[model samples]
Structure formats: structure tokens, C-alpha cells
Target: MDNKNRYSISDQSIRFLNKYLNSFSPTGYEREGQKIWKDYISSYVEKIVTDLYGTVVGVINPNNSPYKLIIEAHADEISWYVNYITEDGLIYVSRNGGSDHQIAPSKKVVIHTKKGLVNGVFGWPAIHTRKSLEEKKPNLDNIFIDIGAFDKKEVEEMGVHVGCFITYPDEFFIMNHNYFVCRSLDNKIGGFIIAEVAKMIIEHGIDLQFGLYVVNSVQEEVGLRGAKMISHAIKPHIAIVTDVTHDTSTPMIDKKIQGDIKCGLGPVIGYAPSIHKKIREFIIDTSKNKKISFQRLVSSRYTGTDTDAFAYSNKGVLSSLISIPLKYMHTTVEMVHKKDVEKIIQLIFETLKGINYSKEKFFID
Candidate 1:
């Protein structure tokens, strides 16, 4: 079963990836991004289910089945929330997720306001004026956004107020025609891959013994809130989750601390406590049989992605994780190899085609 042609990344898909990654889908404010994902997959699935908190599920086989399978990725990205408006119109923000404070200063951002997009820049002190030995570095406490407003009233007039969400304005771009560099790839790329898997499943006319739920979850950066909710809602018998793992091959990254993972090598298969041994082996077998390239990952206590959310749900769902090796995770310039992304989609697509949920041989005693 050669799936290279069917699951290969196309130019049209790259265009979609650019638009989707450039769109602001900050945590807790994911409706717009979910709409983009749901629209892209609507033609490929029979039914779409959106949770109250904006987790979107596209069901290929909606009818009742003996087993349910969920291939999920989170839609939300780390961002900031407007916590306070200084009298001088400077905006103080709090973490909406795990926003990197070190990268916040001097970066461009957009405040999602009721009026429209309000542009702002994170202000920092000049290096020349700072005493290097005693200078205070950028942190949540001191970092502030300058919107060029005179006072708090002026900021309010611009539709920027407390509780407004902010995200970087970094657009998606490809480097050397291979690496995808952008903000929020931490898991948006996950959503993109799973959606592509569903697309391939429909295009290739593959049949599965169990219902396949293509889930794009929300709020994963903030403790997997969305995955936790949807895992309960779906109650899937088996979950194959995809998220980004660090590519430790880059400069300044210690392989001993981050593990030996690299982009363009292959998809990553997780060895975590939450990962069901049988399910893990099943995916590895499928990858090997299909001649798909994949790397290995070992998680100490938890996989730290949506994998943990679903693995612990429904009194322990059988779960495995497949990750794309990502570089500079959680920053504006997060990157992954195009080959790795395509391989992940292929791996997930092939795994779904070959999985036998009804066969006890694939399940542990």
C-alpha cells in the first residue's frame, strides 16, 4: 500500500498552512481558526461536531460503532491577555498560555479588540541606558505593550481594554523551500496534519472497522483544557495524538537534555507512561510495514501534550503519540521540516487504515 502519492504535501496545502498559521487562534479565542479548520475538512467528513469551548470534531463514520478512534491536535496557541491599562495607556498583560516573556519585548503584537485589530509593540529599555550588571531583564512583571495611546481612556477608546487577547503578528514562511517557520506551530501543525489524514482517508476510499474522529482541540497550551473536555465527550477506545517535539540537533540545544530528535528525520513515536504498549507497537508495526520513517521519544511522567489528556480520560483510554520534530518551539520562529510533516500525515493515515480495533491481538490483556 504505497501512500506517498495520496498523503504527499501539495502546494495548495502549503498555501492553506500559511493562511492557517498566520491567523490568530490564541488560547480561549479559537473560534476563527476552528472555522478555518472545519471548513477545510467539511468536504472530507460526514459530520462535524464543535464543543462549547470551540473544540471541533469531524466524524468520518458517525453511526454507532463497537470502537471509536480519535486522531487529535490542539488548535490554540500561547498568547497574552490584557490584565491592566496604565493611566499612561501602556497595557499590562498576563499569560493566556505559556507565552514566552523573553521574546515579548520589542516584538510586534495585535490586540484582538471589539473594534478590530489594534497594533502595538512591546517596549523595552535601551541597552545603552541599562547597567548590564544590574539591568532587569524582560519578564511578565515588567514587559508592557505600547499602543501609542496617551492614557487609559484613550486605550479604551481604541477598543482595547481588560481581558482582550493579544498575539504576535508573525506570518508563516518557508525557509529554503523545506522548513516551515512561523508562530504557533507548537500544535497548529498538529491540527493541520490530522486534518490532512482525514482528507487522505476520504480521497483514498479507505474503510475502517471503527469510527474515526478528526479532532482539533482548543486550550491545550493552558493545561490541555480542551482535550480534557473532548476526550470525555468522545470516549474513544483508542487515541492517536500528534504534537510537536523538540529537534535537539540545532545549535545551543543539548541532545542529552532534549533527546536526539531532528527535523527531516521522520515522525516521532512516543514511549510514555500514558501510551498503551499494544497501541504503540501497532503504530510502529504499521510504520515499518509501510516503510515510513519515524523517530523515538521517551516521556518521563507525561507526554506533556494532548496525549496525556486523552490517555487519562474515560478511565484510561488506549493512547499513542506521533510528533513532528520542531525547532524553536513556543517562539515566533518555530520550524519543522516539510518532509517530516508529510511523513506524520502518512503515518497517521496508514495507521488508521491498518488498525484493527476489534481484534484482541492488537489490544493488551
Candidate 2:
């Protein structure tokens, strides 16, 4: 371990990361995950507050300075909700937030209910039963979950009902010692990374003149709802958003179409209409000054993340994106490289460190 062990990610933080990522923070139902986030970041910040929709904010320097800055990431993961129950207890679902039905076959899932969780599996037709050419593709209409119940009555007895959320049972994992593989890493990893930033700031004893709002937003997958409400409330002058981008180097992904980015290469900085050019340039400058390698990409109409929410809120808060290159996004086995994770943390930390309100004009040219 280095001399700055506490500043580095500790074993305890890793434990928290696993638990947080494993928890059910499905869209519109993020209270459990918000509790986890608030508890973990409580000691690191001066104050903590949650909005009506369960968006948690850890405030480091609560004040009214024009330099108010927000480091943000969404907390919700894509999920499904029970839409119907068959006579034989098979459950049909509707996407809660961009939940991919294409990957549903044979995957284990857990149905959340008022009573508790009921285990289930997404069942598909056996290969023998499926005709080679006439086999039906997996789609929202045909995908369903079986909970080992004989009838709908038995399923009801087990406490599952319509509107109850369902999530994958897949847990957090590290592959090849550097790749983080897990469900919901799309934005939950963003929450983890921002929390680590707060922890490091406390450990390093760095004080900021402006308020640092560390926001873990909810319902971003459902169209940035969580960030929308909270960003309007915080009205931060500068917002730095972190979320995942596709690892186009992976098989089946066309680099020309998705942009040439890869995990273990570096964090991807997004240029978009929502991204303020001056603030974006500031991040690029920070990456260069700190010698942190970074990749670049462009988003046309929207960044498809929380950056759009904050950028256009409250007279347009300066916003930019720092994305972790992720493979298999919106799936059970989302993967990100530990090296890029480290660089993203370093880059954001350095940017925050160098953002001196007294000397910095983030957007004003």
C-alpha cells in the first residue's frame, strides 16, 4: 500500500461497493440504495440530504457561492415490473427503465414484494423444442419468469404481485484482477466513484471555498428524472457528470458507429451540445496537467445521461461528462477496467483540486 492508503480505495470501500452494487436500486425504488450511499458517505461530508424522489446529496461545503460545484452520478439501475401472472405462475414483465429483454433467457432473477424477495428464473424454450429456423426470438412479449409455482394462486401465496420490481441476482465481481463485472454498473459505479471522491477529499484534508454537492441521483435510466429535480434544487454553477460509455472495441460493436473507445484505455470525455465547451476544455486541461490519459467522444442531440439534465437546468449550469468505458451495458454483466476507474478518479479529483473560484472562469469567456 502507498503512503496515501486511506486516499486510495480501501478494503472497506470495496465491501461497500459490492454491497451497494448488489442492492436493489431499481428505477423509482432507490431508497435502499440511497440508504447505503448516505451511510457510507455520512462521515466524509459535512452534511447529507435526500430529495423527495430519493436522490441523495452529500454536501461538503454548504454555501451560496457562485462556485457551487456538483459531482454527480445516477443511482438507479434498469429493472422490470410484474405486468401479468399466468395460470401456471409464469410472470410477464414490463421494462422499468431500459431493461433489455433480449438478454432475459435463462437468467436468474429476484422479485421484490412487500413480504420479501421471491426467487425466479427467466425460462426459455429448450433447444429441442425450438425449431431451428422458426425459433422465436426473445422479445418483451414472450419473455417471462417462472417462480416454481404451480398456479397464480401459489405465486400470490409467495407474495409476488403486479407492479413489484424484479432485478437480476447477479452480484459484483472482479475479473482478471482489473475488470469490474456486475449488473447495474452502468450508473451505480458512478455513485461508487463519486463516493470515493468524497472519502478521498476528507482523507486528503482538502478544503474547498465553494460548495461541493456530491449527488447520487435516482431514475436516470428512466430519463434523468432524479437528476432533473435535484439539479434544479442545487442549481450548481458547475456540474461534472460521470456515467458509462460503450466499449466499442468489443466484438459486434462497430467502432465507426459507436466511437473507438475501450476499457483499460482511459475515461471517455464527452463533447455534446449539452456539454459546455469552456468547462469541457477545463476538464481536458486538467487531464493534460495531471498526465491522466483520456478518450474522447461526441454526442449529438443529448449525452443520454445526467449531463443534459444539469446543463440546461437553472440558467444552464456548466456541465461535462467523464465516462467509464463499459462493455455489455444495460445487461447483467457490465464490465469496466480498474485502470480506467483509477484514472477517472484521479482526473476528477485533480479537476476539483484545481477549480479555484477565485481564479477560474468556468464558462464566462
Candidate 3:
């Protein structure tokens, strides 16, 4: 596809991502986002179901393929919850997921309360007040959110209550021709990819021999909890976990320490023991045949994404990991290449087409 065609996909992905990312569905509170995903993907899939934990599963099976395949993505993002509302109305928050406190200071955030949405900024100690601790990075426990309310009564009147979810208020922005930045690309990109693949399967009228389940999991950022439940329920024969990996273009990271996966280099295929050797080879072969560029990533142990859950779910599944190279992971300004997104989707679609039920293999314990 040319740049124009690529942008079309990027534009659609960005539109869907922005709509879902701006929704107030942090880890344990993903009901709103789940509803949106169900509504959006219902038209394209054969059957859509929600697990007990609110994980959304979309199936597209044309020829009743014997093999069950899962493309897993997490819908949750890192966020904070109001733990205490002080007498002065400043809200102290507890981190909900794997949040990096270094990026919390002086950042804009949204407080999702029972009544309404409240805008706030994470405040850092003033320079004069921090003279003794100038070189120290403040911990998350010391951070507070200022919503411009003067007293506890005002905050209460504004519907700011304990347990309200708070997230960074960063809007999506296009950086270069194919690069874009957003707040929750950590896994929203994965959701977009699976949804688009479902749409393409329907549009092209391609029938797969195996059943394909596209899952938008919840609480992955917290502990990969959602995947564990859904994977057990589905008991897939093969699993592909899509998430963002580090893009080491910024300062402080050594290029050699991390593999040379860049934003526009296509998707990163993870090489870990948990990943099935045959499945990984098939993916690479498909990408090569389709002329899609991809990078090989080596993971020493367990990948800290949904792959960890799928690899060990219900006596284990043949699992592999594909990552979109993302710059500044876990921060408000996460960036990814639009071309890489398209390539990743294409790689996935092609891999689905290449699945054969008769060639199943097992790993020895």
C-alpha cells in the first residue's frame, strides 16, 4: 500500500483509539470501554460474547475450522484512583496499575467521579520547598492532584469521591508522515489491530478453517488477570498476544541492550521459549511472503504482557508475541508508526489465512 492508502488505515485506527482512550475505563473499571468495543465490533463478527470478567470476545469463523486461535489484546490502561480527599480539596491518589511515578509530576489528568468528569493536574513540590530533596525523584505516594477546588466541601459538591479513577489527559497527535503519539497506545493499538482484522476478514469474505477469537481483555496492565480468565474459557490451540514494546530512540537507553526495533520497522516478533517454534516460523514466513517488514526480538524469560497469561493458561497454549514498536512506553506521549500498525495487522491477517488444523504439534513437559 502507498502512503495514501496507509494513511487511510492509520486515520481509522487513530479515530477508534482516540474514542476509546478518552473513555474513563481504567483497570478494574473497564465497563464503559468494554461496551464501546462490543458495539463497534458487533457488525463485523459472527458472534460476540463477554466473559464473566467483562472481557470482550469477537469470533469470525467461516468454514468451521477445528483449530481455535486467539488474538489477545488488553483494553485497560494505567491509571490512579482517589484514595483520600484532604480538607484542602487536593486529592491524593493510589496507583491503579503499573504506573511510573517519575512521569506523574506536573502532568494533566482526568478524575472520573460518580457525578462527572473533573480536570486536574498532578502537582510536584515547589523548588523552594524541595531544596533539600532537589535531586530526588518523588514517589507516587507523595503526588497529589489539584483540581482548583478550595475545600473538601467544594470537592464533594463536584462529585469527587474516593475510588474515582484518574488518567492522563493526553490527546492523540500525528507526529510525522506515519508516526503518531497518544496516551494509551500501550494496548489500545492492539485493540484497534484486532478489530480491523475482523473487519477485513468480513470485507474480503475469507473463510478460515479454524475459529478465530479476537479478545479485548481487561486488567492486563494490573496483572494480566483478564487474559487468564478468557484463555481458560476459550482454551485456544494457539495464542498471539499483541502489545507495545520499547522503542529506544530517546536518551538513556542503549540501542544494543534492547534490540533495534524502531517505530516504522514493522512489528517485532518476540523469540521466547514460551512462544511456539512452529508458530513463530509460520508468522515470519507469512510476513516474508507478503513482503511485510518485521524485526526479531529476543525475550530472556516471561514477557510482561498478555503473552505471559496465554502461555500458561489451562495446561498451556502455543503462544507467540507480536509487538508494535512504541516510543516512550507508559508515559503520556507514547508514539508509534502508522505503517508499523498496518504491517502488524497484515501479518496477523495473513497468519490467520495460513493456519491448518491437521498440522498440530505439542510441546513436551
Off by over 4 Å in 2: 1-7, 64-66
| lDDT string, candidate 2, 140-165, tens digits | 99999999999999999999999999
- Better structure of 1 and 3 per TM-score: 1
Q: Would you list the C-alpha lDDT of every candidate in the order shown?
A: 0.90, 0.89, 0.83
TM-score of structure candidate 1 = 0.96
Q: After superposition, how far is residue 246 of candidate 2 from its true place, in Å?
A: 0.4
Instruction: State every prediction's TM-score relative to the real structure.
Output: 0.96, 0.96, 0.92
Better of 2 and 3 by lDDT: 2
Model 3 alpha-carbon miss at residue 270, Å:
0.3
- For model 3, residues 157-275, the per-residue Cα lDDT tens digits are 99999988898878777786667787888888889888988877777677787788999999998889999999988889889889999987767888788877777888999988788
Candidate 1 RMSD computed on C-alpha atoms after optimal superposition onto the true structure:
1.5
Candidate 3: global Cα-lDDT?
0.83
Q: Could you tally the backbone clashes for each prediction?
A: 0, 0, 2
Alpha-carbon runs more than 4 Å astray in model 1: 1-6, 358-364
